[model samples]
Target: MVLHDALSEDHVEELAQLLALIRRGSAVTRSELVQSSGFGRTAIARRLDHLMALGLIAESEPLPSTGGRMPRGVYFRADAGRLLVAELGATSIAAGICDLDCRVLSSREEAWDIAAGPESTLARLEALLSELLRDHQAKVWGIGVGLPGPIEFATGRPVSPPIMPGWDRYPVRERLAKRFSAPVWVDNDVNVLALGELRAGVGRAHSDLIYIKIGTGIGAGIVSGGRLHRGAQGCAGDIGHVAVTDDQAVVCRCGNIGCLEAVAGGAALARRATAWAREGRSGYLQQRLTEGGDLTAATIAAGAAAGDTGCVELLAAAARQIGDSLATFVNFFNPSIVIIGGGVAQAGNAFLASIRQRVYSRSLPLATRDLQIVLSSLGDIGGLIGAAHMVVDEILSPKVLSLWIKEGTPEALAGAHAGN
Candidate 1:
């Protein structure tokens, strides 16, 4: 039942602020809430009571005190609802069910092709989510998705994603909202990875950072001032298409010549490896191809590990090209750290060393002085966690919270503030 008539807008705002404090673990007691929110003791008590009545927060054991009265610890009710999240890549999908605190309770990963089109991909994803949700009876508060393409943040639709054919302008959020009766948030996969790292991985301590994913394609997620920075069109960090060379012999799937992804992405490296194998320039690659029928970036890395000079040179060349492009970003953005992830980053230390060498050599001195380039610590599950946080952050924002606080459940507000 709606309680909008009982609470004033000012009261709702105050309640949201109080809830935010508790949810972030910033204020764990009545006194802490009063001090953090600058509210009178009575006002803090009233807000806490309201949140507790709504089942959004609860009081735990009392804190130790030196004086007379002990304060009970206020905590967010993380298990009150569940969130469905998925990270969709060029050739794989990772889906999970998370609690309000963005903790994964269950997850599933499968190899699937995004080029199969949005209809088939989303249908398969829906089936996977259904399987994960089958045993749980928790309320699904929201859905978050990370796609391998540019997205229109306001509409949650893809915007001419080159690697994702048949996905341009697809209604991802709308479809998912209709399917599950929950609001959905969609973003580029790399942006999701950046958020995951920011909240759960190496980026937790650093406010300004860049997350670069070198998979079938290469993309970047930029975080400035501790927030994901999606530009005006929500495609700010699309470094994959940045032109790195004037050569026209190499054409990108985006119809561009010598773009960074075409020169150094996992797909590009594999394509080059295949040519090298065909030309007999790499005996190791030829043997691997003859056995496996196709060469991949992993094959090249394996050959390099086996001391194949041609494979090592190939890997180094791709790394140097990627690093050269990254040097421009380092000089311009001056991020505190640059995190490398995705399938290509798994090529081992030699690939990382090559990229680091070029970045340090080509970047400005001041930028390189304090810069730290490292691999992603979260590995494959980063996007799923990021997707969970994305939805939680939105659902818990002031405006959205105000709309749903009266209802006690965001289910009534599904798709109302989606993509906003």
Candidate 2:
């Protein structure tokens, strides 16, 4: 979409803000848009016209009123643009195409490992997006990716991630930019998962939150003042390697001894469940293992829910260890919400209860007093949704929005497509 040439920088900013307000569902009515944004009727009308020209904002059903005339409600156009996202996990990857409002239009999950390295994995991921985009012909606005590794957010490069061997410092942003015309954002998988929760899940009402992911690895995503707090090196929440046990025998994938992930992650829990099955410690688990030959955290959770003693104990132990670390974080970050999600977190309420039990007991009274711990509402799709949202918010920043107004055009977008 080509923007008008006569728009001043301030007006362009106002237009972006107006579009954002409409998208957020915060100011839908004309009076609310004027009162909430402090923009006069004429300016608001002109900006709204610009957004409509961009095929962004649309008129919805009129809102009911107590007085004579009903006000027409405005909302973001779901077909305005498309965002492509990939959440790369340890043993699988999720690919999705979403509208500008961050709603998943179509998504598919496939069994693919990050150990396959960046080149091959990203190629496959882009192919998936291409397949989904075959029918959806909306303009590409952005691309966001969530990797199961520490990411240098500004550069979108991995940094010596333990599990991702060939991904260290790989040029993810550069490579993806070359593959697509839109801007690309890469971040830690857990961080984007927290973003997804903050906008759409249990954390939606709470700005300060800590999202703990317990899948193939154990990590924390810290959000303070409603934004992701990636520390100086983008390693703020790399808690998987935080030592929790003094047992030197427990070696982690990172070669560290007694790391939290070594004892409390999904793979770790699965190993223990396998041992129990082999020893015939839990009849339910043993019966399943006898047929399937292997166990996962999901099966262990199912076993525990079915009254299996060994499975129950194993999950409790993992949760307790993770909880010990979170207690320390609670005292420091003092987040209002603590969200537990990921494949292992599927262990259900019993698992979350175990963590909450240990954390509340270990943390200071004030920190634990009002803390609300809950499971994820978005489940496996949170990362993809959040990644798409992140890019939208990123592009909406004043300076970036102004740049898009200046340089963004259909011909330029076509050039980016060919260049990529």
On TM-score, the candidate that comes out on top is 1
lDDT of candidate 2 at residue 244, scale 0 to 100? 91
Off by over 4 Å in 1: 1-10, 65-68, 415-420
Steric collisions counted per model: 0, 1
**Model 1 C-alpha lDDT per residue in residues 1-420, reported as the tens digit of each score:** 234346777888888888888988988988888889999998887777888888999989988998998878989999999999999999998899999999889999999999999999999999989988896777899999999999998788999998889999988988888888888899999999999999999999899999999999999999999999999999989999999889989899999898999989999999999999989999999898889767888888899999999899999999999999899999999999999999999999999999999999999999999899999999998999999989988888777777888778887677563433
TM agreement with the true structure for every prediction: 0.95, 0.92
Q: Mind giving the per-residue lDDT tens digits that candidate 2 earns over 130-172?
A: 8888868777888899999999997789999889989998888
After TM-score superposition, the amount by which residue 104's alpha carbon in candidate 1 deviates from its true location, in angstroms, is: 1.1
What local distance difference test score does each model get? 0.90, 0.86
